[model samples]
Target: MSRPLGIIIAVSLVFLVGILQGAMASTKTTVIAEKLAFPWSMAALPEGGFVVTLRGGQLIYVAPNGSKQPIELSLPDLYATAQAGLFEVLLAPDFASTRELVLSYACGSEAANNTCVVKGNLSAQAPYSVINTQNIFTALPKKAGAAHFGARMAWLADDTLLIALGDGFVHREQAQQLDNHLGKIVRIHRDGSTPDDNPYKHSQASQIFSYGHRNVQGLIYDEQRDAIWQHEHGPKGGDELNKIVAGGNYGWPIATYGIDYTGAKVSPFNQLPGVKAPLYTWTPSLAPAGLALYNGDLLVSHLVGRRLQRFRYSHDSWTLTDEYLSELGQRIRAVYTSPDNEVYVLTDSAEGQLIKVELP
Candidate 1:
């Protein structure tokens, strides 16, 4: 080859490499907010902002420009300890017009803690504080303990809300009984009244949509299918992703794929009559937290696994297609998709962060 031709080829190669590098850099993560206090959940505001909840019972309003301001929301009964605390925050479907929002948190004193949901309105002015807050729903038979407070919330319809409640750890057997609210998915109207058509409306277990859930943390409503998707943390290994059904029995302690933390078998049978099987199970337990369906894909944030997983549904089954952000090695507690389809994740740490995910 001639010298001039060699020089031209080398220059072209360098130019191509630089172009490739720039393209890769275009799809990168940007930290929107950092140094948070154990952020558990976040919801994007309709007007281009966010309302984030911390496990230590604080609410932070974040502006689009990355500025953070603390919002004072009164919660005199908030019980913040261990795995209990403020959990999920979500805006109403008609939030743009009503400025209404909802949140789930551990309420009551430490000796009698349980999951509770509050509905309130957001102020329009700066600081964007919460006002007129009312405890719309509270799990029954409030048991003691800081673990297993399944306080995730999802809007099943325009007028209905679904709140996931855990077994309260020590009362796992009550999950199979219909006399109480532990280990169940409860559905209620916006005013915290039982819907007229609930499956258990005529029974003693009114408001119970499903039972036998261990400690659900993630929930999402699929409008296309008119279904609810949820996930829960198991004892040692059996994490589950389930399609919730009315009056369904999930078989937590009665039929689990996990053993106790002490290495004792939780149940002898993994399959039982009249119990619904999980759509998916993680043997080693991913500690799945946030769940969202965006662009025909389900995105899951893992606390113990330390990754963001994308699952695609096709032919009535879900398959894992992508994994991301594992290099950061942070415990992701929540995932939210904005109206513009941008993904945001909250890390679970003293110096937690709100990260925006850029896709290629």
Candidate 2:
């Protein structure tokens, strides 16, 4: 009832070869806007510009002319501490007319906080702001501390929203539970309603798409193969890039290739029965933070690794086709490809930047 792996890989090859007559990429970078505040994620606009999010509760619009304008927003009790902040930004599928957009941010006090998603309409012109904001969805059972509130997001082919969540650091075992939203990918309608056809719609939490992820930050939906790809941070080693399958259990503390920061073993086993294995594992910890599809390949940006690595599918798995942009010497926070097939990168720093990548 399912297509074979060989078939899928063959089709993917065709797609790569068909794009721009199978052009090989060369990396060239240019900084379009700079001096950002802890930049986390960015989105390329349907119009002629871009929007970048700083973890410090700010959204700055980078115009085509490279001028930056702070978009006004009022996220109540927006937490900006300890591996948390306002996260990803995504334009609505019909953004040209509706002007609606979504946001994922850390909400509540450090004593009790959760990952939250909100929908808001944008002003058309100068002094651009998100107006009429409303909370669409919020992760339940708010936890203490500011670590591992996974808020990365991607859109499904059916136009549903997918939000990735973390295991609350000390609560790593919850990544295997079903009653709560911690350490899972959740699917909901744009209006924050759960999708009826979700794999676990009847038994598990209606919002959960998959479970067992640790601090997932990179999530993308690939239309070419009708697949969702994600990456997450590992403790001291074993950062992973994974292909998400519905109802799949990606073992975290129960099955890890990495150890605890204290030099203790997190798990006795790195592979287990009924647990999905990673397609690729970054030993020694790449600290991969962002993932994007470039022309038919993947562009993975790293924080600790401090570089961008490109991988192409070959010999039945992702193979490193190229690597570049380490010369800029900044922690690459995120990489995004525009609807028009343009590339962009966000550098993470006190004085962050929105960079345009020319790959032709």
Candidate 3:
């Protein structure tokens, strides 16, 4: 967990008004745990506090008093290297009653690995433990290398799950193919069964709901509007924020505004006949990491840009209304807006932090 550039610092244990000049109305960030080991995602526990994932296969509980306690768990050997490691943790819709949750992580060897989802029940106390864990679903055609697992998960209104899978960096072309699970968003029941109403129910990759995504780090289900919004990382430029539609083609390597990392062309066109265009795009690559809605406003966190941007959808478009936490100079990994609209962010680094932003 070496930080090449170094970690970003900010005012700790203090509250400030109007943290930014150009935009934000009133926002403040309070650093909770300042020494996390490269965490990926978080979810608020129904009882209290949070359950966070450390890339090296550790599930820890963060208390309301800002204390950190590592929870012991029995997990299979994980492909925890580079960008491949433990990812998103999502509590079930009936978490309060069942104490069950879903977690997405990379599983397998260096030469062959794929994204996997597991269901686990949690204990009620401080020395927390995950019990009776079961593998629910796994992405098909395991890929080589360690980049781009895109393991973000969200539960829809009907209690089905949506898992985002990335286009393995070298297998970008497979994004347009439907026979494999790479570069697609799939829908499944809690028990790992493909939903009968899935977009490709009869295809080889029967669980697929949408295809043509790069590495989707941010995903959310807007229950109010019954919509799914996701953001993915692009090559050099062409990062996108898209409103997902069922069975839609998002046009990745097939049609993109971004060129290759080597500056070669990825495609001849940026738009295709049957491909869906982005609701909004970030040129020069903002490196978006998470997405959530705070009081009906969309909040996107970034790694390269080191900021939290707020957008409001009105009049048929999403507009940037404000930005926060950029002055801290940290790579914001995940920003989760709780059910009550409370904001939480995880900075990316070996000595990163879990901070709560008080938004008014």
Candidate 4:
């Protein structure tokens, strides 16, 4: 049985307070390395190391030994308002041959802002030039202000791509509608075209894999269960971690566990029919933005409840057993596990940092 809502909130609050009392009491080793201006998403490289995106529209590479290098790319004019900027960075499925990378960011004229995806290959020469830049996707129903650019990309096993989008803040109703792309999880081919085997293959309006997502900040694939998981920020306290399913609707503005920023009720009930419940919900909002699963057993010691929270599966059936807190006070913006079982995380702040974790 699931825990009570009140208990979950109280326990989360107590955990936060306990961390405050013992701010310097370190359980796992944490190393705050070179800081980036506004690092957003993270992607592991083929040759060992990782690449991060900057909100200022730049790409920074982190070497194996903690050295920093910034790659030069042509940055478009971005609005850089609330929750918008260089949001997500993903490597092309054929990164080895293409050396291509893709990123989502907010861009538009002076009065309006729209999210767009750009794809390019990292140059083989000095400065690491981004060549053959192309705009693969752009938001519909464009409007002003930087908000709800739900743009995170993931590759499916069949080579089709999945993009998570937000329901442009002003159009909360659009989230439940099939005709619009806002507030939706879209499935498309790499060329930005809808696939034929999609849930609503015959209906253009139903390219949506799931709907009513407020602002999905995290998108990841679970190899173990063959399910896609997403987590996003809620209005005030109803942050959520979801197991995404095709053609399903996730209650957003209509049904929520959170309230308005002004303390008004967003919903009177927790579970509503037709709207799916989350696998895990974070009340009081962890502001969770990044997610990645730990796939190994060796380096599991140090990452317990710390940076890389693990959810282990039972033998007969998938039963959740362990839950620990990594006592890291900072908001986790992005998470990715390395090929060697090391964990990497980026904190959310102006002086945001990239930290690595391994078994002690």
Candidate 5:
């Protein structure tokens, strides 16, 4: 072949590869359900549907055909304030046979509210109302106001559950304290009992797994890596994603990359000797919410950023490889993968929607 002809062919191939890469990253989003009132979190059911939570204090069962029914729940302490309300719904690992599920929500009046988790059985009939409901856990030192209720749940392979709690906005310093549950992730058995092997099992705060977090809204147990990954909201500009370590301090206010809402520095130092650094941080705040690890990729749902981010991690480094569905122009609240690996996202809005994401 002529030298000039070879050069032209190589350039054309490069341009073709670039076009294919761009096409592969593009996504198609199908709206599964719309006009929802602030849908927060959801989990796919083994029986062909989803159990979803709404920030307005409702539990909904959505069928495969997109039909929706409100699941009747009985909880007198259920609180629905600003950022506090029904937060997450998760089906048990044995849900196929047990019909059991768990819910995370806010409890108590506006004067003193805190995050809470409850376990219950769903009725066998239509509507599938929650039955035999029991309060399994509640975050301590319930504070006033409704700004930050970091209430997300993930279950380990051993069936133990991990619950993330927020710093209560006004009590950010307590996240550094070990005596309380604020800004901490706690591990407990299915029955709400603390596991004996937990790092703080023998201490006063027996269930505490890790501490020093702001408002963590995303939690996932990555089966591939056998690690718990989480992300939390920062004050102004410092959203963070971390690989949660047992008994580790995450350094909320004392060592933050974010500034106060008033633009004051949150801390003079960004890292402390005892506290662990974030695996990844987002500047100007993504306000990251839901997280899912699928096909070796970390998918994050962003609220203020109004997009979905996909990250690939390798050799202790995380790379933001793609951003999807930004044109939807909606605040994404949560993301989950179906059994077949299809990704679904929930929008945070009065006219909220559940969207299925498809990639080329």
Candidate 6:
């Protein structure tokens, strides 16, 4: 009887260990929520909630638990097509003191349309109206069609605004021309005036902070480096991670490590005399869409896979250090980090999802 009892106890202990191991692995990845449709961009709000933008021109407030409240906000008539629509939603740095929110979307009259940014007040009550809606900036050379609006916004510490514009597919060569605002990152005052101190404010066709970008979908200010960083999609295999600099040019159709969609070579070489090279280039394309620097301690230091890519900055160069795939299989559209170190990501799809990275 004693021998039989010992065997039973041992078998139970092994089974318990296996169950515990499996649970830990699963807990490492908990899906806080899912089933959102065409979610585009996200802005972190106070008290641990986020306001997300949908391609259909709606803003939904999501609590930390993933419960959502669609704020019935009014949007200007927008022409959303292939890759254009409502782009980014962000709170002005002075939101707590001013209650101001800035929105970037594609807008045009029946004849011509381009990407534009507006500033307005956000109310929590019914019928959230964007009072004092002011059109601050619009991309130059309004090209027809709703493709490559390149409408993303970031703020510099000095209270200046940076807006990224896509080279309206009307002409790819326009990317290299400073006279055209398409395919360039422009820096301006909060009121939409070019800054006198801008890198190219004095040159002809130079409201451009940086140039030669294809479609810069991801833009953010990396606080630790005191620099702005961006990631843009490549034609075929040369998706890139870039450390943006004022007055600098990032070679787009010119010095790509990618190929045209037709599977032909994109550029003959990888470097050009004046254009900047990417800090890191992905071959065969991860189809990267969002970028963030992880500030939390729970993430292990050396895993570069997908969803999120983290870099370590040395004195002269950056090395890829970490990456993690989100629960949603779709492309990551945007990434935001709050003051308390919570990382938020928006996935692209008809039914998009907002995910939070929590460390156990």
Largest lDDT belongs to which candidate?
A: 5
Q: Give the per-residue lDDT digits (tens) of candidate 6, residues 59-129.
A: 78777787877775666667676677788887899987777888899887535777888888877443344
Clashing pairs in 4: 166-183, 167-183, 305-324, 305-325, 305-326, 306-326
Give RMSD to native, each candidate. Answer: 7.0, 7.2, 9.1, 7.0, 3.0, 8.2
lDDT of each: 0.89, 0.88, 0.88, 0.71, 0.89, 0.72
How much is the lDDT of residue 43 in candidate 2? 79
Judged by TM-score relative to the true structure, which candidate is superior, 1 or 3?
A: 3
Q: Model 1, poorest ten-residue lDDT window?
A: 19-28
lDDT of 4 by residue, 130-230 (tens): 78888877766577667788888788887777888987777778888777778888887777777877776665465677888998887877666677877
Please, what is the TM-score per model?
A: 0.91, 0.91, 0.93, 0.82, 0.94, 0.84
Model 6, position 133, has a per-residue lDDT of 73
The candidate maximizing TM-score is: 5
Show model 2 residue runs off by greater than 4 Å.
Answer: 1-26
Please, what are the lDDT tens digits per residue for candidate 3 over residues 267-292?
98899999999888898999999999
Instruction: Name every residue pair that clashes in candidate 3.
Output: none
lDDT of 2 by residue, 1-360 (tens): 367988999899998876534334456788898899889988776667887899989998889988998999999868998688999999888888999999999999988898999999988876789998999988977999899998999988899999999999999988888888888999999999988888889865788999999999799998988889899998989898899989999998799888999999999999999999998999899889999998889999999888888889765478765667777878998988888878888888999988888865
Quote the lDDT for 233 in model 4. 71
Give the C-alpha lDDT of model 3. Answer: 0.88
Candidate 6 C-alpha error for residue 156, in Å: 0.5
For model 1, residues 49-139, the per-residue Cα lDDT tens digits are 7889999999999888889999889988999988988888888988889989998999998788788899999998676789999998888
Off by over 4 Å in 3: 1-26
Count of backbone clashes for each model?
Answer: 0, 0, 0, 6, 0, 5
